[model samples]
Target: MNTSRRTFLKQSSFALAGVSLLSNRLFAAAAASNEITGIQLYSVRDDMKKDPSGTLKQLADMGYKYVEHANYVNGKFYGYAPVDFKKLLDDLGLKMYSGHTVMNKQDWDEAKNDFTDKWKQTVADAAIVGQQYVISPWLDESMRNNMSDFKRYMDVFNKCGELCKKSGMKFGYHNHNFEFSTKLDGVRLYDLILKNTDPDLVAQQLDMGNMYEAGGIAMDVVKQYPGRFELMHVKDEIKSKNPGEMGGGYESTVLGKGVIPVKEVIDYGRNKGGTTQFIIEQESYQDKTPLECAKEDLRIMKGWGY
Candidate 1:
């Protein structure tokens, strides 16, 4: 989004466009593996920025076998090249199953009828890091405010799914509070997303806690869209002391310590919503260290039989 980054991507477009795609069969085998419980690295953003290797080692030591990344910049994950980062995780006994990278309009080249080189490199890097899914965590406001544009972007989302499919990966969208609160033509934006995208290609990763502030109930949503969500952001929310942290008077807390029916909802997500990956993510620690919160969340999830 920045000027420098844009220029860099343009300069590297040709080289990255040629990156090879992985085999669909290999990706299918990976997808067929047992369910996973992972942590989103963004929960410890400061620590990762300071010492990615040390932070990862600590997570592995805490019984975390899998992780989902929230940081990727200029074709690198946490400052490490994709292959090198994969090796680091391999050595630490961890696997990165998914990651967040916002795929905005800039990533698409309408003139070429294809993705820009930068996005292609992003997918290439994700494959190199052995990820099953490449998720975009945010939707730009321009795409949301207009009905015609929103529908067009939804089409683009499906096209992205097609691109990811060729590389043995699935393109996924992660939701936030806006999707639940914002509506167009009397239809909720979230519903439009679910309706527009093809299920086989575009997987959904629902953030359970995010929708609460916007009056969206996790239980109802899962029941409404049975067998739609393939992944879930396992989080709990409590009334925030400081309001408006996430455009609502709520912030994430450690699992089982907040108002969310953590157990019941995830149970439904697994049994009825088709969720296979339960990823722990707590954004606010309430005086506890981020790592401490991370440890407790994992313990709680395991106790619940995840």
Candidate 2:
């Protein structure tokens, strides 16, 4: 083992003696609280298209206890009826803790009456599948590239958060690289959105790897806005040693092989804020098959001794 890996293991053994390791496929006895290690389904989207049900079962077998969904185009969740999907998930011993489906203001305006209707239906589906969060993952073109856009965007966010609150679900935002690079009114657009939105009304699904890629420090964001980030994406970025500008126009690497400060960020998120889950997302694979890449990631996390 490398020196860092050995050091990490030694420390974990000394300090986190009873904590279950996330590396191995074995279940930690201390997971009495039902804590989860989830995967963003987007990682295996192609495989899912080929065989959604079978792929889900395979993911469970591969040690992913939970999943965050990506493809719920219409009222239906994952192309199947919600009830049916729920049963399938239950049979697989998996829980859909969150989803990345977006709803825009125009969508709500044209179907304003349908707003509550659609919202109710989505929340009902979440309940059916045991999902706790429904996240808006992107900013439309109109909401980007300028200052005025962010101001308007915050209003929409607050409104959506209120709607989600009333429906017994949490509303969250999942960011991409643009939110970091794009400036709004001399300040970062992300800062404006977080400041303007009600903390209780809106939460953040802080993609730690992407946040680092966006030129924002993950620990700093969490420190500045405590409790707002209930969920976190735990991926690593392989830094380009050449020292060009990092983030925004950035590239991703396999988990645990990036320049991103993985341990410090997770430690900060877990101890400093309300971090609910540390999700693993692998987007880069230059040398291996998808399954090989995922298995390597699992092995790396296991090596971390957590």
Candidate 3:
């Protein structure tokens, strides 16, 4: 064949391939845009007890496409047996992408006799609930008192993270202000936990508002560690009329209206950081119900064009 004809055919094939690739990229972007917003179900812990299935249905109807779980007792999820809740979420058109299950919660229920296999069971139950992450969201007073205590917990965290890895899930730590407020020998316990943990096994679900409450700066943490964070609990805190006598920041109002630089953090997570899921976790339901705050948050996120 002639050289000029051969080159022309090659160019034609390349043009077709580029068009196909651009079409596929547009399709993926459209799919992602279809999901309106997501919420962490801990926002409505009270309503969950009265009516678990009913509450989730309401959330789905309100345009919440994703929900991260915050309840699991024994191998049971919500009050339903393990497998059942997964089916319920599927039926609701909602995905249980993650769960906030720690080593100490209902794992020690005396009648359940499930105390011995605490951490491993936490990972397994997460799978049963269709979760990709099993998040440890708290550290008690003893764990926060010193660096050594935090280090001791890292061993357990590592063990749990390994267990999660085996089950196609990752272990993560969620935070509150206590991690920053109290420190061990001048070192912030939060930083120490990040420094010691194995990155592969442990992921950071850095609660933005809580970190801000702990006296750590928001943009500073994002800039300091580029890719250590995976998930982010998006909350906002209203500074009390008084200072020095503070309450929980996790138990703050919805996003944006409070103090956290949420939109700035969101932009960082997408362009610079490694975070995948940005979950809205509201612990305080004041001046309105939990469901109302969730709707308000969704509105705020839409307003910000996220």
Provide the clashing-pair count of each candidate structure: 0, 7, 0
Residue ranges of candidate 3 with Cα displaced over 4 Å: 1-37, 105-115, 241-251
Clashing pairs in 2: 21-306, 22-306, 213-247, 237-258, 237-259, 238-258, 239-259
How does each model score on TM-score?
0.89, 0.79, 0.80
Write the residue-wise lDDT of candidate 3 on 1-306 in tens digits. 566987999998899999988986875465445332478888888888899999999888878888888777766777888788888988998888777876653333346533346656667778877788888787666666666666766777776677788899888898877777776888777778888888899998887877665687766887788878877777777766434223642347878777778889877865567666778878775679999998888778778766
What is the TM-score of candidate 1?
0.89
Quick one: best lDDT, which candidate?
1
lDDT at residue 178 of model 2 (Cα atoms): 70
Candidate 1 local lDDT, 1-306, one digit each (tens)? 456977888868755654422344444445447689999999999999999999999999999999999999987999999999999999999999899999998888889888998899999899999999999999889999989999999988999999999899999999999999999999999999999999998999999998999988999999999989999999999888788447688999999988999899988877657788999998899999999999999999889987
Model 2: lDDT to the true structure: 0.72
Question: Higher-lDDT candidate among 2 and 3?
Answer: 3
Give one digit per residue, the lDDT tens place, for model 2 in 1-306: 457988989997876655544422233333314455677877777777788998888787777678888887667766888888888888998888888887665545534533556665766676677777778888786876676666666777777777777667777888776778777667887887788878788778888777676678887888888867778877776655443234344445677566777777766666557675667776655566655666666566556543
Error of 1 at 109 (Å): 1.1
Better of 1 and 3 by TM-score: 1
- Model 1, position 74: C-alpha lDDT score: 86
Name the runs in model 1 displaced over 4 angstroms: 1-33
Report lDDT per candidate.
0.91, 0.72, 0.76
